[model samples]
Target: MLKPILIQINPLDNVAIVVNDHGLEKQTVIEEYQLTLVDDVPQGHKVLLKALKKDEAIIRYGEIIGYANADLEAGRWVNESVTRMPEAPELDKLELATRPAQPLESLTGFTFKGYKNKDGSVGTKNILGITTSVNCVEGIVDYVVKIIERELLSKYPNVDGVVGLNHLYGCGVAIDAPAAIVPIRTIHNLALNPNFGGEIMVVSLGCEKMQPERLLNMTAENKRIALADEDIIQLQDERHHGFESMVAHILTVAEQHLEKLNQRQRETVDASHLVVGMQCGGSDAFSGVTSNPAVGFATDLIVRCGGTVMFSEVTEVRDGIHLLTPRAANEDVAKDLIREMQWYDDYLTAGKVDRSANTTPGNKKGGLNNIVEKAMGSIAKSGTSSIVEVLSPGQRPSKKGLIFAATPSSDFICGTQQMASGITVQVFTTGRGTPYGLAAVPVIKMASRNNIANRWYDLIDISAGDIAVGKKTIEDVGWELFEMILRVASGEQQTWSDRWGIHNSLAVFNPAPVT
Candidate 1:
């Protein structure tokens, strides 16, 4: 017998989640609650603790997750179909920072081996990134990247890789739209990300609205580079007579960057330079019970070391906005968070959708009934640390500690923007499983259950599943995650996602209109 186990996220919660897959059956005995099952319940689904009348609110995590649409018996299943979404919190009335951040025991003197950048930032990997001003050049860029990796990369022992930044922006769009600032700043900041070693090499089609010079912002000295102005490579230049000439030009410039990258070696630095991004997808009920909580613990450790940790995906956390405000670092940070929420609300309204539209079939199948339940699980990645800063899409952080970067809940878009914000590493949690990674950064994937991990053991870098079965404490797996972050950040270990070369293309968060 599996003891008919279930988990209660909060003492005030009237519902509990079944932890065992296919473990609940008719006449099940919940010895812990002394309650007999009235109906068959599947694993990862909700089980009511007591009877509820029609139109009563459903509480989870001590918050109104939803309201019952029909009367339900005690110990009966309460899933999405029978629940109605609760009214969203009013942004204006949300409270400001009222609780001081929980202090952790002193975490003195932790370090990782990294390559220091000219701007005083650091990188876990040394790579040569090739930027493009338009998608018309992507085919050639990919060809060049393959050739470089197959041939030139082998020659330079120290250079980790050469990744081509291929994106679908820069053409057929109103470049002056108020929202255009998002994509422009994204491309600009990505070029300066510390992992690229400050070597800006851009390839352009020469006639697109986004000129190479504009993308590179060449007018002002990029004070961050501290290097001589470099020449841009334009494919349409008269000097480049044919395709071979263009390839040769790129190869020559790439070798120069590879040579420079190979010269840089890793040195031990304190954890303060780390900019880490945290996210979750394909999440199940156990996401809150296992992986997210463990990640949160690691988040606290990173924050204590004076490092930065970003937890993004606005829609995924929108339902929990009321809880987040009091954790903001100050009144200004709280207001900024509200402003982002309002902006996103307006954006959704413009598209005739609401936060409820965020849930996916997979989310429902994985035991997350709706966005409200999903948000409850998603925000746990922040731990109990104060949200020290708030960033709009494509904006880099000016301070450290936990940050809330407002981005779409889409995994690809969120990951791309987080990379643009200068995160050197990302820890992704999934209950249903996803192999998402970024060419510009390292991604660590953790599974919430052992069955999923065992099936995709080769893909998942870490497993926090044991927390659900009482085999491991959240602290045990959390400290493991903290150590893994350092090792991965130091380039001593390669994430499974990195090793497999599994990556999603850049999906820029462009709200600008197409011309």
Candidate 2:
């Protein structure tokens, strides 16, 4: 039986959340109080348990989440309300306490099959990527990929695949502006990504916000590769000829790297070398019950092994950060985490976008009711590890541990930024299921429903639905998943994303201009 608790979030709050629903019937008496059923609150939804005057605060997880726009009463259902008042308390002033660190237990010397680069970074997979500077060159880059698929690659089994990254914004944006900088940095990150075997053939229009010369200059100082005679010759030729000829010549040169890449194999490396990114999309009630928690267990395993795991979708962590704050590495990291929360609050308010509107229409139909409840379940993927770092979108992790990346909750956009930040692989949990994938990294789909997994076995690599049906514990499923990660990293299997040919359909965060 589930126990529900009425959580009084703050002293100023007018309402409390039903945290535990102890399976008690309506009008049941407990702790000197007779509890009545409020509106039928779903797992990730809220119910108002008290009456409040207009402008009274609404609280959850012991923090102010929002305010009431109108008078509210007990037993009322709290849907997505547009009221955005009530800022979070300052982290420095908050009287929160930290938990003592547990004894460190690490996964022993487990290494994925990867390409060891000269710069000391190991790639989980090897790929030949045709990077574009702007949309104007998208056609040329795509054409080059067609040529690779048609003419080359059949002879090179080591080459994972060839991809072209095309974006809508790049030529018309202001140079060095957020819009331009985001894409430029993304491209730079992709080129430097270890998954590429330090081999990239960039295609550009010669004139764009990101110049081919500038892109080349950025990687000139990279220590990953020794200046080989063949690489030098190809670079000189590409610089002399225009874009079209350069694209052709680079395709020929790529064949050479592909031959060498095939001979590489997985070797024993430290588990600490692994960095895993956690994400979920198209969620349903079973998400938290099965796939999410199972992934959370895997996250715990990775962190326990001295590896780093990252969880993004900040908006979805609203109700869940409370459970995570106590694990913060230090006061400064905790403050940054809270500051990011506040920043999202202000950003939503300024744009007049209802924060509760965070849940997509599909999400509600799938059983979620509000952001707070949805957030609670979403954070289940982080496991019980302490958060060592809090990162902005596309920021790389400086330390090895569990991290929370502040990113928009959008699936494609967030997934793209995670890949750009050097995550070699993504563990994407889905109940409703999604087909999105990144250009530079592999995405492994974990399905939470047996029916969905059976129907779409081609798209799903792991079926965690067994958890929902009580056939497996999260720990059992997590070990299975950990083994899968190890195998995928060792190049023993192809991820669903790799098979479907889905790549380069997402980009980094760029704020929309205020009209």
What's each prediction's TM-score? 0.97, 0.78
Q: What is the total number of backbone clashes in candidate 2?
A: 11
Candidate 2, residues 117-234: lDDT per residue as tens digits? 7667778877776666667867666777788878887887767777775666556666565434455565666666678776765655555665655544544222232334344223
Best by TM-score: 1
- Highest-scoring model, lDDT: 1
In angstroms, the error of model 2 at 147 is 1.0
Q: Which stretches of candidate 1 lie over 4 Å from their true place?
A: 218-230
lDDT of each: 0.87, 0.68
| Model 2: lDDT of residue 268 | 66
The TM-score of candidate 2 is 0.78
Residue-wise C-alpha lDDT for candidate 1, range 300-345, written one tens digit per residue: 9999998999999999888899999999989999999998999999
